[model samples]
Target: MVDDSLYILEKMRDLNLSVSTQAYNSILYNFRETDEMWDVYKAIESKNEHTYSTVVDGLCRQQKLEDAVSFLRDSEWKDTGPSVVSFNSIMSAYCKLGFVDTAKSFLCTVLKCGLVPSVHSHNILINGLCLAGSIGEALELAGDMSKHGVEPDTVTYNILAKGFHLLGMIKWVWEVIQQMLDKGLTPDVITYTILLCGHCQLGNIDKGLRLLKDMLSRGFELNSVIPCSVMLSGLCKTGRIEEAFSLFYRMKANGVRPDIVAYSIVIHGLCRLGELDLAIWLYDEMCSKRILPNSRTHGAMLLGLCRKGMLLEARALLNSLISTGCTLDIILYNIVIDGYAKSGCIEEALELFRGVIESGITPNVATFNSLIHGYCKTQNIAEARKVLDVIKLYKLVPSVVSYTTLMNAYANCGDTEKVDELRREMKANGISPTNFTYSVIIKGLCIGRKLEKYNQVLRDMASEGVTPDQITYNTVIQHLCRAKDLFRAFELFEEMKSRNLEPTPATYDILINGLCFYGYLKDAERFLCSLRERDVSLSKFAYTTVIKAHCVKGDPEMAVKLFLQVLDRGFDVSVRDYSAVINRLCRRELAKEAKFFFCLMLSRGVSPDLDICRVMIKSSDVLGWTIKAGLLP
Candidate 1:
């Protein structure tokens, strides 16, 4: 029918009857539907500026950027060629396709053709640069815009603010906002949303709330649900669930009805806070309001239920979704399977795994990893290996997590040979060990007291360009200290500093405790004082170690002084600290002092462990005192 119309139009054109550009554009637009736009363009007799722009813009909107550029370059439109609007269309297309460089080149070509590029042209390139994560280049373009006599608008500033926020250049985000204000542009919803999201991402909930208040004061209506959802999500992430709920209520009171996304955010927050009942209540409330739940909402609720060991409830939720005609995705299956595995119900996990296979869902690596982890948790490494073997039958390659889990099991069992074999198998499968993998192996060797192999592993890790993190160094240092090789531990400690890895509080705790354990009480005290001078917060373990060492060294007087110091400095005194003092006094036959400590321990509500009770009972028996060794009534 279109071909017949085109033939009639051509015959009318040959008869010298003039055809309008609108008539040609109408035909071009129709040809676009059939994707024969170029054929119609060739059939047109009179091609004016409207005809050229119409075809060019239509091609760009259809995402045929190359064809649009070719149409613009065609010699037919050379006499009265493509206009600035046509050029902008092609530039916008290139930018949308993430070819910001190509867009810039096209902009230059427009300039060389004596067409002044508009501010909208510059904004397009700026937005494209921002989307591509080239914030610096985007800013440079903004500068170029001002030099070109094109004023930057709210959109340009908003794009800049969002770009800075995404790059974590949070300081620059504020500066961009200030620049917008300086330009006499009122900050819009997009601007406030960007600021709110930035603060939330950086865990600055207070600042985000302040921005929320500022936005309200500026008289912007709370019509858009996005800002409120972002704020609620931030509050939930920062463990401020009560505050988030309050804000949710506030949003509703202010005439902003909670959408599906808002419901999901609050529900997820409740789930994470372990308020499973509240989460379920919210889920039901949303459904009652006819707000449908998405996969994320279901996933969050299922995870919460499984974590709380409410497997029956979680299964019911899944079945309900299925009954409602919602397709059960593999992620949902993985979540339940992993939850069951972690809860030590390996049989239930296997049952779910089999169910997924029967349901025609091809199990991914995460599915197998969950099952392998379950077997490992039960100390069934052989079964875990069988699961790994089964991956091959399904034509699935085992992930690094698979090898890591099984390697850790063998390492825990002190089977170094199996650990080495798994490592070789991983390498043969083209899986290079990550830093986490090396850390696991090093820790395992340390546990097995294979110090030489541990040192070799460290060297191998360095050769592989995987630097040992604080946890890695701390593990090796702690083991060395346990072996009474304080000298080597100290050397590694110095090496850690040299590598510019600042020692964590755990590192200091290990060193100080190691020093005291090796009978270097004075050195431990001096080191603790130095750490205090450097403003490094000492752990209670450090203080308790010194106290225990003092008590063992038979200096009860010094131990008592340190105990008072710990109290004065506001350090937590554990039951172990009280027990050490009591045990020492009992060994010295000082029943009165020992009984006093026992009484103090009870007063603090720290229930004495069996070790504490046993020593106190023996002292009471020997001294002939009828004092209770259990809780003092």
Candidate 2:
């Protein structure tokens, strides 16, 4: 289009025809992005107000604010002084580029030139302020609009409401809506959509629903599916998938055919809830409705399939998309590649990686990292290192995840030298070690049983300003417990508290189990009781650990009592916990107690495993009762 305009302008000049200023202005506007616009401007026989405004608008559109301002100031050279439209062009461009203050300063220039500001001019400044999160300034500007003889329009109020919504000031958003109502300005669909979205974002789905109903009753046209999509997303985000599904159906029933975005929201929600079957059903429904799914929809399905370890299905879907000439995004490829890697399918992952490169899709850091992880998982460190080299070859910098994955692999192999080299290389690359990196190193030290080297790593962590989290402290403590250095383990536990890291239930489970293993049953009991007294929420495993310990100490009654306590606390009992108590009771020849506990296990919906079944069978046969007669009821 620009070339055609340039050619016509050249031909007109060759024919010696007098070119109109309007023709030059038109060419300048169309060819603004190109250097030819300046050539056209220079060839103008006489410039008019339109020509000057066109030039200023062009310069402003190009983000050359200073040049646009210069042209606006020099308009008098062409016998046309600056106008409000010219100033507005510069202000609009400045506001778009986030120069709200600069745009605001130009308002005085508009007034100084004896040109009243238009509603558009005020709206532009108001929007810029709102977008810059200067909501207070935006409100002040809107209030000043009336003083400037420019009343705030719907766009003005909408921008302010949106700004307040973005800042999560929903009350302020409501106030803005109220102001619109008080001013006798009827709220439009956009105003209602913003209000609906604000409520949905705040997890007030019910309130949003009420607003939607009100919108419907008022006959407000919701031509777009954005409001419904917002509601669906909020419902799904808050784990209200069933409500989202109902809303999905309600949308269709109300003749608001769900668009691709709406379908994607519900589909992603279902996938997140592990309801793959339902998600696929909805995907099929979307296809049948002829609402084509985009990359996000396909990506959500692929993720759901990958999570279920159904790689073949996910790959088939990928192939189908590719066969249909769908240009899949790198994100989808990363998902499949990472899935294959995590599932120990290194060869398949590498194959896909090659295919991505061959298909002209540049592999990202995540792509290379997945392959590296794949190789590391298969104990193919050499291949993993080659993947790192490939990362550099592709000019993509390795992320902290890349270095940490390799370091973890080396740590697993007990190769501290390789781990140290990777750490140094990471530092050289200007990548600061994250907490995960320190945790990996600490875990590696524990795995290698290099107990004496812990102090150095701890000191290194401190020097690096990396505070050890609960997981790191737990790792060190578990190792110490395994080594029977209970004193040191307890000391580390205290250190974790001093460092303000609250030990999780997993920590207690590890400690109690370790105490039981080391024949410190009494200590384990005391610790459990102390925690219970403190009202610290303990895992059922903690109680079960002590129960198993009491049984090992030949105190069947105490084990039974602890098992009852586990049930009384409303902690969901696992099969292992039930089996531990039942097995001990059966072995102690307390068949009636064992039968009662077995019945309770079944009543509690805890399925007994084969090991527990065998224990019961053996005990029933010795007790001279049929298996069903013993506990099946």
Candidate 3:
């Protein structure tokens, strides 16, 4: 029988005898992927009416559809062609290759020859459109098939399920499954598996498992481990850890062996929950079971141990992994370094960082950021500088976070010069500073004065549409108080309020202090009460500022009562706080009260600086209470 089929196929080859255009099509289609392309054409040229259609089919399959179309549309081809099987094969070829329009044109020629499209015809084209992701078009073609009186079998629904699965269309997956049922087509394991994969890929893994269970109840055996293993992973990611374990235990009960992927997933879940020991134990269990851990499983174990500050265990796992012929990937090394740095082990992090570079593995942005932050926290900004240089040297584009980190590092160290330098570098690199970036710099500026330069930054911020946030407004408000720009500070405060940005107690402290520094006690008092009424609590600084406001107004007794109020509140009033009142106190011959607060600051944790001590001694001397104040100190 096989010999007869081969001889007939070859005779269709030699004779070039196509019965009809369809017969010619079959010949053409057969030659598409074979080396006998010219033989198919030769068979066509022979003009044997018996084999013309076979030759044409071979041509179409050989991707000579256009040539076959041209030849068949010739006056001679219509008169002599091959069989329907030949043409059907050609049409199926065109559809499979995503040349549906070309296939349609060929079908029109077939209809012109008075031949109708078969069920095979509909299946091939519908499947092609499904593969091409033209779901709507594929469905429409299926409808057309129905109109042509062609019935789609279970294979048709299965193809559509595969299409939806490939496209990650979860919602429509069950709809297509329901269609198979509505059409009285029995659902098979392939059908359920396809839909389950779709649901899981679209993050609806639980739904997928539910449908799988339904399939099982309907006699779909739980024989395949891959699908259940993948579902176990999805359950773990969504924090259904116990359910994932239950599924794990159930899989074993059902005789589905857990593979590398399954073990990796369960270990990964444990790692996410900070259960490193459990993850390690599972690794040992995999080894005992003789189920060799894959690279992913090994990397998970390493990272999990690293997360728990178990670098020794991570290193040991890494060594064992190398013995398994899986070289440590860059991520495995980076996770270890990040763990070391976060655990405040800078020396270990740098050692690993250098080791990574030496191993010829380029460190990514996260690696550099960890080192930079660690250096900054340890006050070794110079080491941080070297890291920045290395980052630039590697041509690694520093992200906004990297630039922001450098900005923060300088600001914390009170290095405005470096802050300005880094800002220019940031712009040169086309990295815009976020509002958080501006906030850090302004915070540093608040402790020191650079009103002119600071105003420029604010203007730049406004122009950039990076509208300052509450911290931004609070920062500038706090600093403007130091410079005593009461009217301008008041205007800025109102601007914050008008924007529906309720000022914090820090905001009121700055504004009230600024108002009082310039002798606007009434404005200072108004802000104080406003701060209190808003339930935005006050600080010792706010009390100190109000007390100074009164002391500057020649009411030293009122200042003394406010000072006691500050101590009662447990807010540490700094030497600077007392000196604000004393500076005014000394000028008013109230050296007695000034010296009293100066001694009060030392008794508290607020250390009096050399300058504050000098100021107090000088003031006491002029008031003839110099010996008393010095003795008190």
Candidate 4:
């Protein structure tokens, strides 16, 4: 119908009737909705400023920015071309698209055209710069505004405050707020909200509450829930969930209804605090209120339930959502699949994966990755490989996680060749190995006793800018200690410390075991003492190593002392611990002392193993034979 009307209007114009600019604009507006701008341009008998402005503004709104610029530059209006309004339209479009640098460059064109940029023009460019993370450049532009006779308004200050907030420059945001107040420009709700969110993000919930109070005192009603939501989120983040819940109820009591966002915040807080029962209650309460849950709310509840090992309840919740005609997004599916996989319910996870495909929601790499992880956990490598093959069948690009999971599985099985092949394939697919990938490969090589490959892996990790984490360092150090390369192990340990990686208990265990095995009793004992001095919790393994070392060094008395110390320190003394002490005393021809330990072991309800009995019998003492014959206790 519009096309026919345009045709009739064009015919009327052909009959020497004057077609107004308003008629041209009307036709252009209709043409803009479709891709028939050329027809409208041809229908206009004489194009004027209104015709050009309407076309340019419509093009800008549609985000056909290049076409808008081309029309402004080379159209019939080019000679008597674009007004300030037309220029502002294009600049605002650029800013809206987050191309602040391009918008800034276009400001020069406005100056070259002798058109003074308006305050709105400055604000648009300033916002673009702020969003681009160029806060300094934004500030300079704001200063330039004053020079150009354009004073900053509340919008300008609000943009500056938000930019500074994003940069984590909370102090600078306060300065902007103060400047707004000094300029006699009252900070609006947006200004206050930005400040509130900033303080909340900085974990200054007290200051955020004060800001809330100030906003309320300034005649801004608690009509907007955003400020309350920000404060609630802040409280929850700082572990003040109780306070957040109080505020949530207060908002409702004050006649300010909580939205889905507000409800999600409180729900997440409850989940974090392990109050899942209350979280479920809140979910049911929201339903009773007819406030429908969104993806975020559902996801929070699903994750909370899954974390609590309530997989069955989580599945029921998902079913309820589906029954209510709510579409489940990929994220929700992935969360549930991962939850099932982690819970050792691989069959259920795979069934859900099939449901995803049947529902026409294409399973992503995460879905397959979860299945692969589940299979790997059960050591079903063949099934995991089938999932990897399915990834290619679906024509989906496997993520780094996909490759790393399979690589770790094969590495754990000591299939180094397969691990290498997967690493090559991952790189061929343009996926760089992350720290986790290198950690897995390095650990595999260590376990396979391919210690010579450590340097190459370390070099590759460095060249790829992937720093080895604590696990990687521990793996290397343990391998070195097992090989009896104590010096190298110590050097790596020192290097780990220098790099700020704290040594774990496993690290100390490996070192102590290696030290005792090599008969370095003195160094091993000193290291254990140093650990105690440093308040490091000594493991039972550490004490056992030192006890065995003392026995190896022909110090039966010292060995007994260490054994007694182990008991006094509350470390569970193993049978091997008792056997080591008894065997040492028997070897030293202290049959009476050995018998005393044997009787003590029996009295403590620890039945000695055959090794301990043989050691006592080999001493050829009648008491040992009598004890073995159950004639002595």
Which candidate has the highest lDDT of all? 2
Q: lDDT, candidate 2, residue 198?
A: 88
Q: Report the error of model 2 at residue 627, Å.
A: 6.9
**Per-residue lDDT of 408 in model 4:** 92
Residues 484-596, candidate 4, lDDT per residue (tens digit)? Answer: 89999999989998999888877898889989888888899899889988989667888877876676566767667777777888766667778877777777787776777
Worst 10 residues of 3 by lDDT: 622-631
Best by TM-score: 2
- Candidate 3 or 2, higher lDDT: 2
The per-candidate count of clashes, in order, stands at 0, 0, 52, 0
Per-model TM against the reference: 0.58, 0.61, 0.42, 0.56
Query: Candidate 2: what lDDT?
Result: 0.85
Q: 585-633, model 3: which lDDT tens digit per residue?
A: 8888787887777667756757766677677767666334534445444
Tens digit of per-residue lDDT, candidate 2, span 397-458: 99999999999998887777788899999999999888899878877887776757888988
Superposition TM-score, candidate 2 onto the true structure? 0.61
Looking at model 4, residue 627 earns an lDDT score of: 58
Better of 3 and 4 by lDDT: 4
Give the TM-score comparing model 1 with the true structure, all chains together: 0.58
Q: Quote the lDDT for 629 in model 1.
A: 45
Order of candidate numbers by TM-score, starting with the best:
2, 1, 4, 3
Report the lDDT of model 3 for residue 253.
Answer: 85
Off by over 4 Å in 2: 1-293, 451-455, 529-540, 555-633
